[model samples]
Target: MELSVEQAAELRELVNSRDVPADIATRGRIVLWSGKGRRRKDIAELLGVSLPTVDRWKARYAERGLAGLEGERPGGAREQMPARVRSRVIALTRMTPPAGTGLSHWSTRELAKYLARTENIVVSWHYIARIWREESLKPHRSGTFKISKDPAFAEKAADVIGLYLAPPGGAVVLSIDEKTQIQALDRTQPVLPVAFAATGKRTADYVRHGTTNLFAALNVTTGEVLGECRPTRNGKDFLTFLKKAVKPHAGKDIHVVLDNLSTHTTWEVKEWLSKNPHVHFHFTPVGSSWLNQIEIWFGILTRQSIRRGTFSSVHVLVKQIRDYINSWNTTAKPFTWTATAGEVLAKARLVATNMKKIVNNNSN
Candidate 1:
């Protein structure tokens, strides 16, 4: 074989360069040796390859320069998964596993096995996983939802949400709720402080000291919390807290947002509302207490103060609760409520539609 100066230089570089593929470099060496008047038998021996491999590369280089040595052999590409198989995998992923399999959801391996057993379609778990990734499917995770059954859900939600979005001028809007039966638990051993690369640790076992109830009233405009720890969360305690919450804005009309708890609608509370005509009550829908902003503050209190605190007695727990409330009031900012009444009603209608479909399917 004869070669141009450029081809000779390129072949030399290919054989010497580390980045080129080993087989391509070997072929470059064969071409170079052939160009230098070397015998086929000697080239095979020097390169540790059979005579047929040597002849094949030499012929390929002769017919197509450089390009012939770069690509795979004919039919070297992987075969794609069949369309029917991919569709089957996606369909099965959207359903529960058959009974007696004891699978609440489908795993990649289990789905592959089930397909092989029942449909006689053999495929690897990797293929199914790839299909899931392409389709954005996750069978191993689940989320929770609740649809309010309150007949007046829309009306009640709108009333409370309206108060949050736009409170009446010169009237104080307060969201009130009671966190009942908050237990004071003392860890059996002292908690270990957090260290480098380790989280703080505490013993799982604890001593039950006692329980207390917290009545909290959150001012909507100001985000300040007026809270009291009481022994019980009965109607009387709620009335006392309400009076205290209302005392500051004396003479101004007060609009209170609260859940539809028995304590809130008791006879005494109704009588108090009648006597104090300036005060108005707006109740959140049943099972939809999340509408009240005070519930959001209570969640903050639990996560920040009560969840990990080691209270030896009820008195200690009460003091901690009071301290957190005082600290919160010092730098309070109102929670932003973005959802409008129409948006909430639209979502509720959607959830209700889904529930009705599920119920109809089950009945059939």
Candidate 2:
């Protein structure tokens, strides 16, 4: 297709610019000479270049148009397997490997070997790597192994996401999750509080004093976080923390979304939930922790505030966490959930179902 007006202007500017290399200028001149149907000898003499260079430019321009002039040669053999081969490769990758290989998915080397041995195709590891990327397939990975075991996952996900989709007035929707075993470091040399002066200095070397757990509840509408430091992350400890944290906003029903941890749904927690009818629990799907917005907030807390702090004791650790929260509540803002329920459903349900059908569709 012909270049657009803007594109043509850009090309003209690029061609005239001082930064434009002589090779590119030569190619453009060659095209101009060819437009007049000039002989290679005449063109080479006019440009004061070799006849062979003129011939090479003419051949490249004839074969690949403007793309070849930019040093992108298109002379390599066409992909042997084609798009059909790539589709087959992805399908085979999802299948269980041969019995002895003891692998669930195919590695690049293993795939190359499989193709060479079984399909009579002389495939290379490099080719397999390129094709896999071209087809948007990655080698076996831990995080990529996701199985949707929750049958009622979609329905439950909708209900949970809907709370944030449009929350009730005067009632806050908090995405609550626990960051267990947060280590507290103690400086061997007592960290003298630095005064606001010309020489504001503090100690750096520190020692770790075991670990403490942080039970954090983040108000999705308002970015205010209420966090408590617990000795352990058991059900009783979580319940106690929740009781203390929820005291500030008691009258309204607190809809807390947490992961499906055993401690979160213990008998003690169940009993507490029964007594506190105003507090409701919504659990994320079995393997879908990414759905929790609190996880993202926790990551920020770890990265920005908590990672490089020295704490003398649990009390100091708790104080620091509280101080950070207080500072954050002043300026911290809640994250906007852009992925709507419909968009999530499309990705999780519709896309997954179609992918499965496509995987199983090939009549092999």
Candidate 3:
């Protein structure tokens, strides 16, 4: 049941009055309760207030009503940035930070300080952090930031990506990339299985001795991996791997996708390529290593097989990597391209914009 204006006002007055004693405050609650059920006598007894006094309060309340209620306190620090200012702050962060700032991106503290100084808008670091999280612009460390500097980057990239997207009929599109000097690491202490609690314990210890290089070419459509391993992934080693990867697809126009590495286009390798008219080379765009599906496979290999591995020598590392590849090929499947060409182009445009900003900044 809704409260009568009189009863609400009576309760409010009792709650707010400085002279009202605790017992009377108790009576005010009773008044509301009794008024709710039309139980005046019970309310009077419960509050220890005279029934007549309750009636008078209730009558006064019916007249004064909700206006007699309390109000909020007026003093507090204002919000750091209003909605509009917060959006502006995000816009500034997305752009490059000021030159000579010795920082690639703005830390929340730096951004907050900048806002306060430049816009005369004061905001707490907590709020700034919240905004970054909300905007999905939090700074993170990723290996992808390391980029290749290929001058013929775009042309090379288009060729490679095209092979994957539209390979010549009855021809193979192989994406080749090299992971050089991978160190084999073994855990210092033995790893224990969770099931063994008290006994039947076994321990194994290991160390990282040295590194070896891997050159792999993957058939994008077939999930077939063909390549070689060498102590040094120099020009010779790269070319050797290339020949091995290409020989199987000989007599046809085989599209070989690789990054623009110094050794890849050496005179020796080029001479070999010229002799094999049927073989073709495609290069990934500069700075966009993510275009290669093999890169994704490399990440999986590192996480699942390479990391924390202790190989006694380069021979052992090479063997392990080869074993992993064989195992993978046995059950490997082609990666489905859910990202359409149009979507990729849209993202590429954004990346181009960011790169232009960087180049412009460098020029200035």
Query: How high is the lDDT of residue 330 in model 2?
Result: 92
Estimate, for each residue in 248-274, the C-alpha lDDT of model 3 and write its tens digit.
876777877776578989999999988
Residue-wise lDDT of candidate 2 within 202-268, one digit each (tens)?
2233566778788888888887888877778888887887787677888997888887888888899
In model 2, which regions exceed 4 Å deviation? 1-147, 184-209, 307-320, 350-364
How well does candidate 1 score on lDDT at residue 127? 68
Question: Which candidate number would show the highest lDDT if scored against the true structure?
Answer: 1
Residue 275 deviation, candidate 1, in Å?
Answer: 1.1
lDDT-better candidate, 1 vs 2: 1
lDDT (tens digit, per residue) of candidate 1 on 229-272? 99988999999999999999999999999987889988999999
Alpha-carbon RMSD of each model: 21.4, 17.5, 21.0
Candidate 2: clashing pairs of residues? none
Candidate numbers, best TM-score first, in rank order: 1, 3, 2
lDDT of each: 0.78, 0.66, 0.64
- Model 1 steric clash pairs: none
Query: Candidate 1: lDDT over CA atoms?
Result: 0.78
